[model samples]
Target: MKDIFAKDSSGEMVSPHEPGYDALIADIFATIKTATEMNTGYRTPEEVHEYMERILGKELDATTTVLPPLYIDYGKPVTIGRGCFIQQCCTFFGRGGITIGNDVFIGPKVNLITINHDPNPENRSATYGRPILIEDKVWIGINSTILPGVRIGYGAIVGAGSVVTKDVPAMTVVAGNPARVVRKITTPGQQ
Candidate 1:
């Protein structure tokens, strides 16, 4: 059966477990290690941006600017929609799939992680992953981490330094480690 999420040459449905899966996984793992070990080393913003462009192997959009020293380890596929802004020193560890919708604003030092290692010493060496989804118009504050299997719904606001381990309901504001709902957003225009 074909997988709806899998992309073909024409961007149509394809098998998710196609022949290229293993190679893709290997490549991602190798790149992940390199990304984890990289040192920003006090470079200026312009230099850092240039470095990231080379490391990521894609040109960053003019509108979607990443400040200096952005560290992302995407072990799996990650899709970032248009007009998104990701700040400096952010880490996106996408072992599982990570999907960020349009008009999303991510503050500095934010971490979007999508995998968890096993506690058992033997299994710990093996790899595991989960999916992370962030819908449109969401604002994730500085130093916040969205963990594995998390879905931050549309128009939600995550406060600074929060750790998200669960689903964030739509139009809500959440804060704290293991982030909880603080309030609901009543108006779109309101901050």
Candidate 2:
């Protein structure tokens, strides 16, 4: 089981026993501290962006806007692109990784979870993950949950409250639990 999903050098899973676990824990706690500071009070847009940049360890574009009460585990594996807008109360479990491209709009209360717990009860505490990729110009509807390992392609529209478990094709609309393709989009000036 470990060989199939090991993320560390030891060919072992990430748990209390693995290398870098202590530092990972420390980073999580630090993120918690920053989240407490950033989420507590009413902050201006610029302030919000500032704090988010600090948390993400990367500068966000000036045009990009993010509301407060945003949550994350470790910021090391998260990369958000330019001109993105992340709504309030979005939680990112970025232990694996999350890549958000330019001009993406993530709706309120959206959860981008990258942690996939070992299904075996004996090893449930151990986690393996895959990156969640949101391509440019994509719109994720309110309350949607983007599961680990799915790529939302460019110009795709994820319907509200959908649970996306697979890659969405570009210019397509997806909805429902284990989201299915509902429609295909046609761009102007093209057939």
Candidate 3:
């Protein structure tokens, strides 16, 4: 059976005219409800966790600290691991699914976009899903934009204000509009 909503499992294009469109719209509204409540006020860490769980429909790992004013599109396709520190004003378009590994640090105003619309004018209403993966111990800097289908490797660091379009190699530093590799760091005690 085909899932109407854009998820990582399928590369099929999703349009508002699909058969299961009503279910998709329901999820969108539900996510908006939870996101509004969670982002509006001075919610404590515990409260934030609770709201996040409701939004995602799953248990958020312990020790994951998320500041208020976060935005997400379709939270069910997203998975956040333990011990992640997500700063304020981050936007996640998880329609294509997002897998964030443990101990990751995402700086403020970061945007993780997982869906892209078809370029053809007549099919512009249709969108395709491509998952985004962030491995453990990675740090994404402030105002960075990670595009669809990007896999950030472990222990990597993304410099502030970057636009990542491709897979980032492990243990390296990347920055710039297109985000090129700047340097590779040696593990402590190795050199």
lDDT: which candidate is best? Answer: 3
Residue 89 displacement (Å), model 2: 1.0
Deviating ranges (above 4 Å) for candidate 3: 6-9
Q: Candidate 1, residues 2-49: lDDT per residue as tens digits?
A: 333243212332232455656545666666655544443566546544
Candidate 2, residues 91-167, lDDT tens digits: the string is 99887789999999999989998887778898888877778999999999999999988899999999999999999
Where does model 2 exceed 4 Å of error? 1-12
lDDT of each: 0.72, 0.85, 0.91
Model 1 Cα shift for residue 89 (angstroms): 0.3
Q: Order of all candidates by TM-score, from best down to worst?
A: 3, 2, 1
- Assess the local accuracy of residue 142 in candidate 1 as a C-alpha lDDT between 0 and 100: 92
lDDT of 2: 0.85
Q: Give each model a TM-score.
A: 0.71, 0.91, 0.95
User: What's the lDDT of the predicted structure labeled candidate 1?
Assistant: 0.72
Which residue pairs collide in model 2, if any? none
TM-score of 1: 0.71
**Candidate 3 collision pairs:** none
Residue pairs in steric clash, candidate 1? none
